[model samples]
Structure formats: structure tokens, C-alpha cells
Target: MTITSKGRLTLSVAAFATIAAGACAEPSEELIAAARAEGMLTTIALPHSWCGYGEVIQAFKDKYGIEVNELNPNAGSADELEAVKANRGNTGPQAPDVLDVGLSFGPTAKEQGLLQPYKVSTWDSIPADAKDDEGYWYGDYYGVLGFAVNNDIFPDAPQSFAELKDGQFANSVALQGDPRTGNSVMMAVYAAGIAEGGEPGADALNKGIAFFKELKESGNYVPVNGSAQNIAQGTTPIYFDWDYNLLAMRDKLDGNPPVSVVVPTDAVIAGVYVQAISAHAPHPNAAKLWMEYLYSDEGQLGWLKGYCHPIRFNDMAERGVIPQELLDNLPPAENYARAIFPTLPEQSEAKDAVAANWGSEMGVQ
Candidate 1:
């Protein structure tokens, strides 16, 4: 979280460019001073184990003296929104300071008036689609939708979505649980649609549904969470895992043979996660300040360590945070050149579509 002096963060769109030039050289002294004056922060993560977040939060606390209280470690996007609605206009002792959520949800949340806007100075560098037009939320780390192949399981691994749909891999592939249940998985549907001609501004996800239908006919998918453990133990052959999970798994295996991550030759879905501040944030100033830091060069670099593609902020890539090895693991910067980020308006429609038609359209609850 950060300090919001008169509802403004330390960094500004005009200053983001200069600040990126020398953030670590001399941290934002002005920003930190503002945070000190504000005094506290609260953060919310839609609860995974927060393996990377653990280190990030510790540093935030140590540097700012703000308690980064992360509530609802296991909640989903829906849960967070409900909290926002329940606590509408109440940035009290129990309200949230910050929120961690999917890219699609950022627009949905902002459109619903559930969020507050803070355009980090790096705002100019960020792609227009990845963040809200009004700065309702800013995407941090994001990944492309891809199929994770286990070299051990398929003698001749599939190379494309079409191959995954081929009958040869019957009962071998795993669905990313239900789109109804997993936000990351849900975005994949939108991404897969891009492969099927669902261009920008298309309201229909029928292409996505068709692809899944073919997979179903192939009997290639098993209902399960993104449990890479299944692959490690040979319980499942392949699943739709992220680049980081596959890379981290390879690192642990001591060799790359057991797993491989791929970016489909067809269009890649732009699945992203974003950060937002509460409209009723008690530490509104602190929350805003935290956003400034989070979007700063120093902050964006933190995700490079987590194996995520940092949102483009003030040409952040020029910095030395990403070494050669990590860059190799990433699907070449060029692959991201064509990636599709969600808009708030598009996301609102998609979320509603998923909720209203997922069961009948995709056999998902």
C-alpha cells in the first residue's frame, strides 16, 4: 500500500520517465517521505501460496515500516469484489488497502466503481490495453496462454493447439480446472479464442468453446487444478501450466527433459494479473504511494526474479534485472509483441458471459 496525499501518489505520469532513469540510484525519497506521513498499508491477494509475494512483502515492510496485511489468501476474484461491494465507501479498520487480481477483473472492478485509480509514472510505457484507461488498475506480471508438455509422457510432443486437439493425446491433456473456478484458466479461454479468430473487440468466445469441444471429443482433458505435481509424479501427462511453473519445475528436476513450456504458433492469449487500490482505502495515501513504488523500475524488476514478463514501464527492460538465462526461458520478447491484453469493457462482458453461459456453453459450472 501507499500514501495518497490529496489522493495522489508520489510518482506522476510526467515524472515516471525521469524516475525510471535512476530509481535504484536514489530511491524515491520524496515518495517514502509521503508514505511516512501516511503511516500504514493493507494489501489483499486472491490467495495462492504467494511464494514470490513472501519475499516482496518482507522487503516492503522492512523498507516502509508499513504492515502489509494480506487478507484472504485463498479467495478468488469474485470474493475480492464482494468484499469491495460489502465495504463500499468504507475504508475503515476492516477495509482493504490494495488488491491483487486478474487483468480482466481490473476493468470489471473499475467499471463497477469498486476501485480507485493511480496512474504510475510508468503509465506512459504501459500498453493501453493491459491497464485501465482511467488508471483503475495496472497490470504487473503476466503470461501468455500456452500448453505445458511433459517430454517424459509424449514420445512425440504436440507443437500446436491443433496438435493438442489431435486424437493421439486422448485422455492425456488436462484442462486448467473449470473456467468458472480459476481466473487464470478462464483467461486462457479468451486467449484460445484469439487462436480461433476472436480478434480484438469481439464479444463472442465461441472460438474458445469450439476448441475445448474438440479437446473434449478427444477425451484429452482431466478436471484438475494447475497441479504440476501431477506431472512430476506421472499422475498426469500434460496440462495448461504457466511458463514460470514449467521453468521452476525444470530447475528442480536438475534437467529439462521432464517438462517443456511452449508458446502456440497461433495467436497467444494475453493473460495478465493486475494490482489495484481500494476506493475507500483507509491508508489511501499509503496505498497510492505503494502503487508508485510497485510500478517503479525497482518494483517491476522484482517480477523478473519471479519468472514473469513485467508490464512495460518506462522501457523497464533496458535495466539489468533480467539476465540472459531468464530471457531465454521467456517466450522471446517478439512473441509478446502480438500478445492480447484485456480491456475493462471487454472484461466486463467476458466475466458476465462466463458466469451466464459457462455451464451450458462449455459444460463448466
Candidate 2:
């Protein structure tokens, strides 16, 4: 991802609407309800590659019978977070109506006084672990963390990190990036811990560090931002990435050669893509409406079509919405239960570790 001096980043237009920026107004039910009645919605968010945003974006318009005017719908999580922070909490013009960010950054944003809360109608469907206790942010579509291997490169794609580092895969491997900046990579670490012990109680962090360190030494480390194209081409034979990207890339390259994606036998870590009303939003009502629809059954089903795992597993199964390909690739619903969100404390701990240990351990700044 590229950043400018203003610190603004461009994501796909859909991502901007998913968790990006739109507008801001004074917080008021009357003001928001009036806007909803007027049939107008302006929003911002992050885009998913599986073409998921369009489904829900259109749904919002149909459900509310509104004219949607979403702006800056092309920015990364950091871009969205900065935009919300820059705009929210102001009287006018400077605030965004809502915010959508990644799970790891949600706590950081909330702790910095960047978000406000509104419990949607379908809140019950969302696991308590996915939403903020104070309602600051809510998890929407989720991705399971795992290793995506180019089977063409590795005749035997290793199922565990130990095998990954010690095998012939050494020179062909790639790690997404830093845990703090990369959601999937962080989940990989957490998943490794879960595989070694269990999350919030396991000692996988140290093991992950050791494994990655050795992975780096093995000359297999592809440290670039995870590129599905690169992975498909075998520059990165063994890579860690989100399930959706892995699945999408595999399908996209299926004709080229066989590509493999798996939920590592040891564990899985569910990373929640989050949504929050920006502290300084131009359309708070629209933001709220968007949140409501996102949690609705119709919207949740849209998630499955886009190849993302909806937060409501039973709902997806009952609707028969989970795809056979994805289902076949999954470990189990119980495996997803291993999902964890980064908290303020976890952020602090990771920061200290990255500062105190990552550079020397992983050879990254």
C-alpha cells in the first residue's frame, strides 16, 4: 500500500465504502431519521476482491429506497482510520458519518476516540467477541487465516509451520508482512499459537517468531506485500494470506496450474472486517442504516456469494449459502471459533514486541 504526506491511501472504491469515509453531521436521531425517510445514503468502506461490495451496496439502496452517494470508496484501513479521525467529532465538514476498519486497528481507533457506537437490529447474530463491548465497532464479513501454497511449487504443501520452515519449501515461501500492519499475517501468528496451544492463553507467538525467523534464514522469505499474482506464478510457492484471496487467486489461476489453499491442520484465526460510524461523518443516518443492512440475513448471504465467511455460521448453513468449494476447504465451524480480535492491550504488547523483538527476530524494521 502507498501513502502520501497527507497520509491518505487509496483502496478500491468498494473498500472505501466498506470501511472508508463519506460525510459527517451532528449526532441526532431526528436528523438521521429524517435522512433515512428522505431515501438518501452516503457512505465509505473497504472493497473486497470477490466483488462483494456491490451486492450490499445495491441492497442498501433497494432496502431503503434511497439514492446512495458514497465517496472515497477506495482506501485502505489506515486511510479510512485517518480520514475518520480527521473528520469525525467536528461541527461540520471535518467529520465523517461512519468508519469501517480492520479488526486489529478497530481497538486502536476506538481507544484514540475515533468511533461511536450503534447496536444494529441483527446484533444478536454477531458474536460478542466480534463487536465492541461499548458498541464502538462491529465485525462484518470475516476471513480465516491460513497458509496458501502454490501446490505446483510444493508437491506436499506443509500443514504445519514446522514443516513449512524445515522442508524443500524454504526458498519458495512468503509471509504476508508485519502483524500490526497486516491483519492476515497477525492472524497467522495467532493461529500458529492456537495450533501450538490456544489463543489468549497459548505460547505460539514465540514459536511463530522462531518459525518465521528460520523461514527468513531458509531464503524462502518473500517479504513483499502479498501478491496473489506472484503467488500464482510460484514466486511465492508457500504464502500466508486470507482465505478469500487464496480462494480467488486459486480459481483465477486454476487453468494455469493447480493451486492449493488449506486451513492449516493445527488451527485457524478469523479476522473480522469491521464497521463503525465515523466520529465525524457526513451521513450518520446512512452509516447507521448501512450497519443495519450489513447485519441482516440478506446482506449476510451476500457475504457467502462473495466468498467471504459471514459472521453468522448457522445462518449461512441454514440458508445453504456456504459454497461447496469453501466448505471443502474449511476445517470446521469449531475451527473458526479460534478467531481472536486485537485489543488495546494486545496492540500495546505487539508494538512492544515488534519494537523490542521483531527487527532482530524477523529482520524487518
Candidate 3:
């Protein structure tokens, strides 16, 4: 099924509806009652802006009438795991019932017995490779690395990773978080390595470290964590993050200083973020309900509106459920045609390499 510029799919709506009607069942009434009785779900490391989560969360609340207690919106994947560990015995508001973390963190969390398994109703639609057979965790959405530039600060945005090294961007480029712990930051380094012609595994990671080392040495890399406020304030004029994040930030900024999101032409590295229920959840039923909502068509569309490619995008597209406007608003589909999705082992290896070497090798901590 091809997604043309017109945002139309080749699959007939009648054919898809017949298949989808039987496939997409509503959440069970018993589950809804149980979730409502629980009343709330605690979640960690979910930023309102990332993947259009603000809208998604609100929608879930509106639909289920369950309060969502969000914790540490800016925390990274490692932080999310630590939160679960720190609050294992606590059922208070501080405890996180759900986690949305980097793909590599899923298996690690499960191995550590930090996650509980509960497959959503739409689990079959998820690609087999993107989910664990036991349903401990599943890929939610994906996006490629890109640069979000404050146009007011840098009139001519850098179109590629190579361009970021130029002296013209001195003290301007910044990663969204610390590479030592942040998934997106680590992936940014991987993307850089790929752009520098390094092979995809350890070699690319090492080269990526070298690339950042040079950037820091040349005074082009800003040590501060980048955020939407930082971009508007011109503190981190060129921020490295997922394409969806930058696009969402651009929309939120609304031309104030005018943000420009560029998917680097040199290398396009796609990363998937997964969702899981915590093993020690205070509101297990609510957490399950939240997962059910996220995998639903409405929830998937929310992420798409935020510029993320939902994990079940192909399925929805085939079903002709995705809105044409959402498809039209996305960055050129060609930009993602070359996106490289690293394997689980590759991501784990690269993540470990960054965690161990980022501080010593780049001296950026």
C-alpha cells in the first residue's frame, strides 16, 4: 500500500472496514468499571509535547474519566526505571504505574522484573518485531533524529549534521538531554557517526563520540540541556531531537522567533519508544486502560497529529482511518524512506557505549 502525496491509500475503504470492524473492539465494560474504581494512573517520563502526549492524555481522561498522575515529565529512560525502583513499595502519587521509555530499556526493565505484561486488544496489529511475545512492552511510536533551529538566532539553518560543526554555529548546538542517560541524545550521537561515514554499530558510536568531542573542542556544542523555552530564549539555538519533537515545538512556538525543523540529509536514524505497565503499579487496572486507549485508533491519531509515526501507522493507513490532513502535514515521506532502524542488540550496544564513554570521551558531563 503506497501513501501518495495526496495522502490516499490504494486499499479500498470497504475492504478495510470489513477487516477492521471485526478487529478493533471496544474496551470491555468490566475493565472500564475497574479502572474507574482505581480512579487514577501514574506515569513517568512523558512530556506533554513529546508525541502529542498532552492531547492523548487529555483524551484518555475525557474518555475514561480517570485522573492521570504524571511524574517527572522531563526525565529520561534511565530516570523512569529508577523511579520504578525507588517507589516499589510506595502506592502514593509519586509511584509510576506506567513507563514510556527507549526501546532498549524495555527488555532490561522486564529482565529486572520491573514491568508487568498485559497485551492491548490491538496487540495483533503491532509488528511482531516491535513487541515482546510475552507482551511486557511494545513499541508506541517512532521518529528520526533532526535539528530544531531558532530561526531568529540562526537565520540560515544547518541542513545536515556536517553543517553543525561550522564555526557559524558556535555555542549554538545542543542535545535535548545528557547523552549518558538520554535515549534521544545517544541516538543523536549515533546519527552523527553515521553521517561521518562510520559503520552502524560500535564503530559508528565511537565516531559519533569523536564528532561531538570535536564540536565541544571547537566551542560549537552547548553543554546545556535543550528545551522549547531554551530555543525561544536563544540559549540553545540549534537543538538536536526527534523530528516529531521539533515539529511539535515549532507548532507550539507559533512563529515567535520562527522555528525550523530539519531532518538532516546526511543521516536519518529512526528510534522507537515503547510503553509498559509497571510491575508494582498502584493502579494496575487504570494503567491497563491507559494502554488500551493508546493503542486505539483515536490515540494513534493524536500522536500522528503531533508528527510522530505511530507504530501501527501502516495498519491504520491500510484501513483508511488516518486523516488526510495529518498525512499531508508531515515532513516529506521521502525523508523517512532512508531512515535506518537499528536492531535491539545494536541499540543496546550503542547505549552502553555512550553511557560509559560520553563523559570521559567527550568531557560534556
Candidate 4:
């Protein structure tokens, strides 16, 4: 349950290449042929701005010539599970072939018999704690919760959750999504509770609900869900989301309104998202191939480019395959060193608390 950043790891080029070659070996010809014959991969809840998936998806298509049918890009983790259950008998574009959902959702989906097992070639390199031993689901990338601010609206952006409660931030703050279903939003609340001196379990979640209620009472919390366009347009100038998401928004906006991403010193809660193939995937072979690409060195680096710390980050770093420029672009390593990774039980408890009380306690529709 405790996750720590290894900072920067280094190795000589010769040794690095030797290790990287074996770990990132290409998929088998049989798998490729089978996947190509399927011709398409259906994915749900994958937004282009999340985890550098925009370029990652394009790269997959370019490499394998397999068409990717992306379903509702903005659906939440719960929505993804529902999709699998709803499309169990449908062999259409609507049935997701693969899923990338919050870590807590993985076990729930597996328990529901909605996930299939298949480990990637680089499976050995992935941290054991971050993966399912049976290969039903595995961690892809992780990031700490942070704030994304529009500089045009607030020349000096708020740096902490406490700062967000000020009159200056009134009508400016928004969560990435409704905490009732959005994993990121639930974590955002938990992080705020930690900032407010609450512990990591139900206590923190309850405190988080109270914190949001206070913010709402002060007219600082916006009821709208935050997004890239909303942030750029200054409607939701202060958005709470994953650091990678905020950073991606900053890059995509190109400073039209300028944005700042801040990892608050008050509390740093890191969240990991996992990938899995649906049990009744329409394109089974294509789903497996997609998993292969995501866990490969190239796919990992693509996530790094978007500011996510890929689950295999330490493995790749130690192998010296990570480019120096990418390392330099990430937020200071110290920011992550202080991050608190909640256990699965703690996350479930907090999620339940937030889901049950967010609307009633915070009074946000």
C-alpha cells in the first residue's frame, strides 16, 4: 500500500540495452496476426488528455494498423464496469475490448467476473504490489493529486487546498468529476481531508466532505465538473485532478490562458490506475495486443511524456532507457517522495464514504 518514487535510476548503456531488449521484446508473430485479423480494439473511458493516451492510441494504430474504437472518453471507473456488464452478449463496437480503470475498480471487476487474465511480456518488471498475481488486472501509471489553475483568472494561483477556500477563489474551484463515481474526484476529496489533518481512511473522507461543504458554503466550490476546455476558458480556473492530467492540460492549452500545476505541500495522495481485458471482449486477440503495447517500453515512455509515472518507471529508469529530457520535465522528484499511497481497503472505505455523503454533506448537485 506504500508506494515511493525511486527518484532517478541509472545504468551503463551496454547493460541497459541488454536488459531492455529482453524486457521489451516484441510480441509474437502469432499474436500479431491474430490481432490484425480482428482488425479493431474497443476501449472505454479513455480520454486523450489522460495519461498521454492520445499519442499512445495513435502510436498503437500506426504500429499495428488496428483500428481503435474508443467509447465514451469521459466515463468514470464505475461506468466502465457497468459497460462490461451491459454488453456481455453484444459483440459490437459498444462492448469494450479493454479497460483502464482505477486500481480499486480492478478487484471489484474481477470479483464480478468481468475481467480476463493475460500478463504482458514485461510482466516481471512490474512491481508485484501493483499487479494482480493472476494477471486479471495490472497497474499502468500513477500520479499525485494536484491543482490546475488558469493564470488569466488568478495571477497568483492558490497553492493548497486551504487556499482554495478564500474569497478570491469563490466561484473558481471545481473537482474533476462527481465524487460519487469518479475515482479522481474521490481521491481529490481524500487529499483535501489529509490537508485538513484527517487520516487516510473513513475519517479523512468524512473530513473531506466537510471541507467541501465549507468551500461550497463560502461560494468557492463550483458545481460543474472540471475539464481541459473549462480550465482554459477560466470557467473552472482552479481544478483538482491528477498531476499528469493538469500538466497535459497545460501543454495542450499552449499558454493561450497560461496554466500552473501545483502539487500541494499540505498533502500528496498518489493514485494508480490499472488495465485489463474484458472477460467477454469482442476482439479478444486485439485486446491482448493492446495490453502488450501498453506495457511495452514504448508505451511506458509515452505515459512519461504526459507526466504520469508509469508503473514500470523504476524498472525502466534502472535500465537507463528513460530519456534525460523526460526526467527533467517532470515535477520535482521530492514532490512524489512525500506522496501517500492509500491501501486498497482504505481507498474502498473512503470511496464508500464519499459516494454516500458527497451530495448530502456538500449539497452539490
Give each model's whole-structure lDDT: 0.65, 0.62, 0.88, 0.88
What TM-score, over all chains together, does every model reach? 0.78, 0.74, 0.94, 0.94
lDDT of 2: 0.62
- Model 2 ranges with Cα > 4 A deviation: 1-45, 61-79, 88-97, 193-203, 315-348
Instruction: Tell me the tens digit of each residue's lDDT in model 1 across 193-229.
Output: 7677775433445566667777776687655555567
On a 0 to 100 scale, what is the lDDT of residue 69 in model 2?
61
Q: Candidate 3: global Cα-lDDT?
A: 0.88
Residue 283, candidate 1: how far off, in angstroms?
A: 3.5
Model 2 lDDT per residue over 1-365, tens place: 01012222333333433331121122345645766774555555444454266666776677566677654655556666777666645545434566656676778788887777788766765778777888888777777776777767676777765566565665677766666555556567656655666444224455566666766777666676556777766777777877776776677676466776777766655666777876655666777777766766556656655667767655445434334453554445554565554454554454445335656777667
Q: Write candidate 4's Cα lDDT for 222-306 as tens digits.
A: 8888888898877899989999989988898899889999998799999999999999999999999999888888888888888
Q: In candidate 2, how many Å is residue 223 off?
A: 1.8
Model 4 residue-pair collision total: 0
- The residue-level lDDT of candidate 3 at 251 comes to 90
Candidate 1 Cα deviation (angstroms), residue 153? 1.6
lDDT for model 4: 0.88
User: Candidate 1: TM-score?
Assistant: 0.78
RMSD after CA superposition, every candidate: 7.2, 9.7, 3.2, 2.7
